[model samples]
Target: MLGHQLLWPVVAIVVMLVIDVIAVPSFLDLRVQDGHLYGNPVDIVRNSAPVMLVALGMTLVIATRGIDLSVGAVAAIAAAVACTRIVESADEGAASAAILACTTALAACVLLGVWNGFLVSVVGIQPIIATLVLMVAGRGLAMLVTDGQITTPSNDAFSGLATGFVLGLPIAFLIALGMVVLTAVLTRRTALGMLIEAVGINPDASRLAGVRARTITWTVYVFAAVCAGMAGLIIAANTNSVNANSLGLWIELDAILAVVIGGTALTGGRFSLAGTVVGALLISTLVRTIPSIGIPSEANYLFKAFVVILVCLLQSPRARAALRVRGRRAASSKAVAA
Candidate 1:
């Protein structure tokens, strides 16, 4: 069962990798320079780190049959807040200022998460509608923080959060991997996973059974926000600047696609962090592969949409069954002719 669930995403990733290699023969090449890893594969993972982090939290939120449309906006807001602080600091290079800026941005994200939780769990707003509120307003808030301008801060310590390397691997990738592992351990190692699934499967039943559905729902939103915030920090560090409007644009869509491709049902129930990671990597690879494969800029999105649809269809049970029936029929006809 597990293998079947993972089959399509794995296949998609392999197919994409093959395509990438075909398009750019050096796509698979890897080497060490100054004790740091460098390659297309490494770049894919490094670039995908932000989306992977967001998808990790999105996995839990989706497990509760909820969605966070505001993750991108929240990420932008985090970047805005952090960069603004760093830029406005008397000593931009000060480690203390960088730390304080990051800390403040993360704290704000937590509060934003709490707001989403309150709307969904306490006020009984639809998750989509509740998060949508922020999706629209959060960017404006981000712009406000940046004074409606792109804020660039020159701080080596802050930039290192994304660009620095540890043990020859990208620090961003390491941070994302750590978050994935921690999330898996927290959810699966405790009773939390089961309770979350129960609530997702049947909130009323879970409530009746003494599983605090509201609390689980609320917690997931907060976690999602924090994850987005972390991703925002990495993104800001990557560019050493924050463009409030475009910083996290469309990232929410990528995160959702990652969650969907990871084999988690939108209807909610069980979830897999490993699968989500693969999905994120797949999306990241596709983003890089499209241009390298000679797809026109104008038609890029169309090509991507077609590939996504094909993958989703391949993963569908009915589609698989239909294909199997056709294969069996073809085999029978061949045998009879022989």
Candidate 2:
């Protein structure tokens, strides 16, 4: 059953890759340059890293029947904090400055997460509303950090995070992969995953069964914020600057789409990290391929929307049943004709 559920998303990714290959023959052309792997495949993975990380956290939050709409804003704020700190440091290129900048930025994000968790868990605000508060305010906070200007910082240690390579692969990709593995291990190897699922599946029932629903909920929100923070850092590092307004603009929607495309229910319950990863890759591929295929920039979003809708329809149970019925009817007709 699980395999069946997961199959369509995998197929969708393959289909998109095929489309990419057809549109741009060199899409799959990979080469080793300067001891590092370089290609479209590499770019897809590297570019999708931020969304992948955000979606990973979104999967957890969604599993708990919650949404963190503020992730993108959190990303902006994180970038703002990190870059502003780096620029302010006298020794901007020093490793110590980079470390401090990252730490401080991530710490701020964690606190923001705590605030989000508090609003939902203690203040009894709806998850959407609670997160919306941050979603709307976070960018403003980021702007304040950057003093309402784009922050350009020159720091090799920071830039190395996004541009550097590790073991012949992009460091960004490696970091994202590492986070995915860590999240999977931390959740699956312990009772945490089960507890979270239980809470997500039925908070009232889980509480009755000795689950700390509040703690689980709060923890997931914090984790989501942390993920957003990390993603923000990656975005800033990639550009070697921070544009608070655009750093993670509308990324929450992308993360949510990734989670949904991966087969995670928006209504909450069970979630899949593997599926989310595939979904993020699918999105990244589309983003990269659209421009190559000569789609007008103005209508690019329309094409994406259409594809998303088609994929969702294909994943629908009713649609699948109808497709099977049609196949059966066609087979019977063929037999009759024979």
Candidate 3:
């Protein structure tokens, strides 16, 4: 559905689904209960929503030849700010408090993005180094926000973001889908997509050609933080608590992996939202499949690494060429034997 470029990711997911179906025959059974859908597929999508949102923003950042290592940290800060605000509110359970908490959290994320953007786009720091500063310190900042303790606020309105369903679908997934669509429309329907690619492909050249390269880069960093912020809110809502230390640890790595698996080169240039969608789903499916198929929990990372490495090799042009050369040599040997 996302063209030939997405074939491998799609195939990987399909294979996993097939395996899941065999391992758990009822994997695909969908039952509606209380106006909500329940099943492995639904669960996978729901579970992957936060990652998808982060990856969506990561895609744009990568497309602009930049990285946001601070995304996970930024998410933690956002959750900390939000949950702390709600807990300190006069009415923690009030809808207004939840709304205010969300707004404040996103605003804090925006400011953090501005700081990152300033360092990279304005101060001329390497994206990785610039974001790394925050990555290392953001947890401490979050701890400060919550006094080094977990904040568990009682807010049904906020919790609904993660636990509630709308029209038989997960609200988190729907939010992700909406953001994906909105991002697609804004980038594709306008000249912004080309400008971003141009900057990624060659910043100096694009700047000479009248593209606002720094502006584009800064904007993408900010957007990435906002996406991370939304993801943080969802994660905090899920447990109805915010543990700054663990809110979004290592999620940045997953977002980067999703972007790479989606066929977006780390070196930048082109991007595909649809590919990312498949990639995120693939990652989620792998998580689900591992336990269901009896893989040891201790080896989960290793197993996932193996699969990811295999897929990456399959996707590499040089690797494909080497395989082709081997195939040709084997063919010649067979002919000579004949």
- Per residue, candidate 3 scores C-alpha lDDT tens digits across 1-338 of 32366777778888998998999899889999998999988999999999999999999999999999999999999999999999999998999999999999999999999999999999999999999999999999999999999899999999998988999999999999999999999999999988999999999999999999999999999999999999999999999999989999999999998999989988888898888898889899999999988999999999999888877777777887798899999999999999
User: Could you tell me which 10 consecutive residues in candidate 1 have the lowest summed lDDT?
Assistant: 1-10
Instruction: Give the winner by TM-score: 1 or 3.
Output: 1
For all predicted structures, in order, the TM-scores are 0.97, 0.97, 0.96
lDDT of 2 at 181: 97
lDDT of 2 at 160: 81
TM-score of 1: 0.97
Of the two candidates 1 and 2, the one with more favorable lDDT, higher being better, is 1
Q: Cα lDDT of model 1 overall?
A: 0.92
lDDT of 2: 0.91
Worst 10 residues of 3 by lDDT: 1-10
Q: Measured by TM-score, how close is model 2 to the native structure?
A: 0.97
* lDDT tens per residue, model 1, 1-338: 52386688888889888988888898899999989999988888899999999999899999999999999999999999999999889999999999999999999999999999999999999999999999999999998999899899999999988988899999999999999999888888999999989988999999999999999999999999999999999999999999998998989989988888888888989998888998899888888888888888999888877877887888888888899899999999999999
